[model samples]
Target chain A: MRALVARGLPVDFTWCEGEARARALSEATGAVGRRLDLTDRAALQGFLRAVVDEGAPDVVLHCAAVSQARGLQDLTDDDWDRAVEVNGRSAFALCRALGPAMGARGGGDIVLVGALDRGQTLPLPVHFAATQGMLSAMTMALGKALGPVGVRVNMVALGPLGEGLSRALPASLVEDYRAFSALRRLGTAEEVARVLAWLALENTFMTGRVVTANGGI
Target chain B: MTGRLEGTRCLVTGGSRGLGRELCLAFAREGARVAFTFRRREADAEDTTLRLRALGCEPQCFQGDVADGAHAQAVVGALTRAWGGLDVLVNNAGVQHVVPLALLEEPDWDLMLNTCLKGPYLFSRAALRGMIRARKGTILNVGVFSSERIVEAPAHYAAAKAGLRGLTDALAREVGRHGVRVNMLSPGLLDVGLGRMLMPHRVEEYRAQAALGRTGTAEEVARMAVFLVSDENTFMTGARVTPDGGL
Candidate 1:
């Protein structure tokens, strides 16, 4: 939100699970914030209808995801279902609801945010990786599906970053990730957001590609 | 020719028919003790078992849903208890539906993700325990070659299979130090199983795009699956080997 606002683009609407956070983000970016639970089909549909009524935004950036660090032995069915619903299913729903409108209106850009663990040498969240995989492939399929209409679909795969989710990871693991990267440091939120902004706003020719911003990890 | 997988214990999911059946036969021919799981199709399971028996190796067939963790654990448990340990596991069970994204419902999405993506995760997770303990094992995830190519009305299938590629890469990295090699085999349009369902014109369309100018056979892909899980695949891990006739 900050990246787009900083770039002088008015982000019309934003959403999150918590109302307070949504309001906070609304204040931060001057975009309408709606408290949305993506797992609820009715609520998601309502949100989609509302967005469509307001006219489909020129760019749709799907970055919302729910994940937990559970090994195979510890992961339960509920965990899998939640991750798939929130991370995987919601993206599909967004594209399904919003893609045609974008295509009909002379094209738009849809940027999916994913992880940079294409072949991580370290142990990471397996369930999260699976959903990222789903997102990546969907990007390819949608890229081709919507490309003829001028819409571009792509994914920006980010490596270990210094803020947000990485902050929740173990300090030791963060250190290990830093050493693993060729740049020997974790990326900043600005750096990742810049990449997302670029793919969403600036890139013209690249589609169906995973533009990895992993510091050469 | 000497058997490449002599004395090896192998398990293949969804082995009662199609590419899964072909993989079972290939492993048995290479001199491995074969076990397989099928969701339904008792007659086909019986036939596959008989075929394996003709190759002079006893085969076991389990009936269960690959997506269920308990079923995956039970299958791996039985195989490990009976054979001491499992050496190779092929995550091959899958279900596909062709529907445009606009018309696709939640059930359609769940079915594909459960069978194609979650099945591999559950089975691989169950098998990894023994593999990690023994410091040796190979897991081959069967994916589709169309994951990279544009296909109509297969968004769910493409997502699930491509997700398997993600799992393959991450799992390989997680277990490579333990000597458990994990790789993905994405086969292109073959004249078997799912490919048989394609319209003739669609088949021709795919052929025209391929360098080989023809769809491949399941046998050709199964051979590559064998090589991937065999000793010959010593140095390769976290790789996606596509046998798509150069599409």
Candidate 2:
């Protein structure tokens, strides 16, 4: 959000539950922030409607993701459903809600933030990997469905943000993940955000594509 | 002020002219001890070295064909020995042919595959030896955007570039555990390199296709190369990045 604003794009952001942090970010950056539960279909619909009613945004970027890193033996069906609903399903809902209006208006862009799921030499939870795979497939499908109308759909697959993950995992483990990138470091949110903004604003012919921003991972 | 890559040791293949020349200068400007290989362009390589010296850095020049596995190894070996360890490797040596698939000869096929695909593989494998030992290094292979999508390059050229994607991914997975990373930089048609001399028509066509409606500058592409190999880009491996201004 800060990066997008810094790029001189007006950004309106949302969080699932972090109202305080979201509010502070919005206040600091002059971006509107809304606290909404995207996992709830009714709430998601309402939020999308409100956003559309206010005036359709040129770009709707979905970066909200939920991950539950549990062993296969310890995972539950509910956990799987939650992961899908949050990461994959919610994005589908958001696009469905936005696509038609954007199509009617003749064009817009939708970007989903995805993960470098399988091949990056990193450990991924079964649920998280499945959700990301779904998102990847959906991104392509959405691009094809929306392309004729000038709406572009794309995904930016990020590897690992070492500094952001360091708060939860050991710094050494974070470094271990960082070593997997050709850059030999973890990516910054700002860097990934810049790519997202580029796809939304600069990239015209790119659609149904997954751009990797994982320092080459 | 210190540059971002201060004290870093860097080497670029085919650094005598075109995008390779810009990459050599960019790395040198960033405070890296830069060296490069030029297959047969002694004058061009010497000119590049003189320019680097003017930038207050001594740049080393080598003559070798990166397509030759033995030559690739020798270049890496000499550089590793001289610098005590290799820090960054940019596989920028490549040849582009525009003939149709139906007309591409066997020799053209061989040349494309050897220079574009096998060159990066051999150079990366050779560089990985010292990098894995030091437990740190970055490798960027210069690739064409056609490798990712269908563009009107010859069958051999497209196939070779696509093969480079495979090489980058496999090498990244293989050496990543050793603290080495490998990636590819796939650029769209630029106004420099063989594009200027061989494909002026295609360059104009690509400019029309690009989102920005202009072909990219070599320096713009070089900036992305520098970032991908620098400390700032830590979490990207087996990744293919394009700085084509959106084609």
Clashes of 2: 13
lDDT of 1 at B167: 88
**Candidate 2 local lDDT, A93-151, one digit each (tens):** 88888887787787888989988534455556778788888998897788767766667
lDDT of 2: 0.78
**Candidate 2 runs further than 4 Å off:** A1-13, A20-34, A37-61, A67-111, A116-154, A159-209, A213-217, B197-201
Candidate 2: residue B6 lDDT (0-100): 88
Q: Model 2 residue B28 lDDT?
A: 85
DockQ of 1: 0.02
| Model 1: per-residue Cα lDDT over B1-247, one tens digit each | 2497898899999999989999999999999999999998999999999999999979989999998999999999999999999999999999857777889999999989999999999999999999999989999999997685676538889999989988877787678767787877778788786678877888888777554456778786786577668865454466565556444
Task: Write the residue-wise lDDT of candidate 1 on A78-192 in tens digits.
Answer: 8888889988899899988888888788778888888852645657677777898898888778776766666777777777777666666667888886665544567777767
> Quality of candidate 1's docking, in CAPRI categories?
incorrect
* lDDT score for candidate 1 against the true structure: 0.79
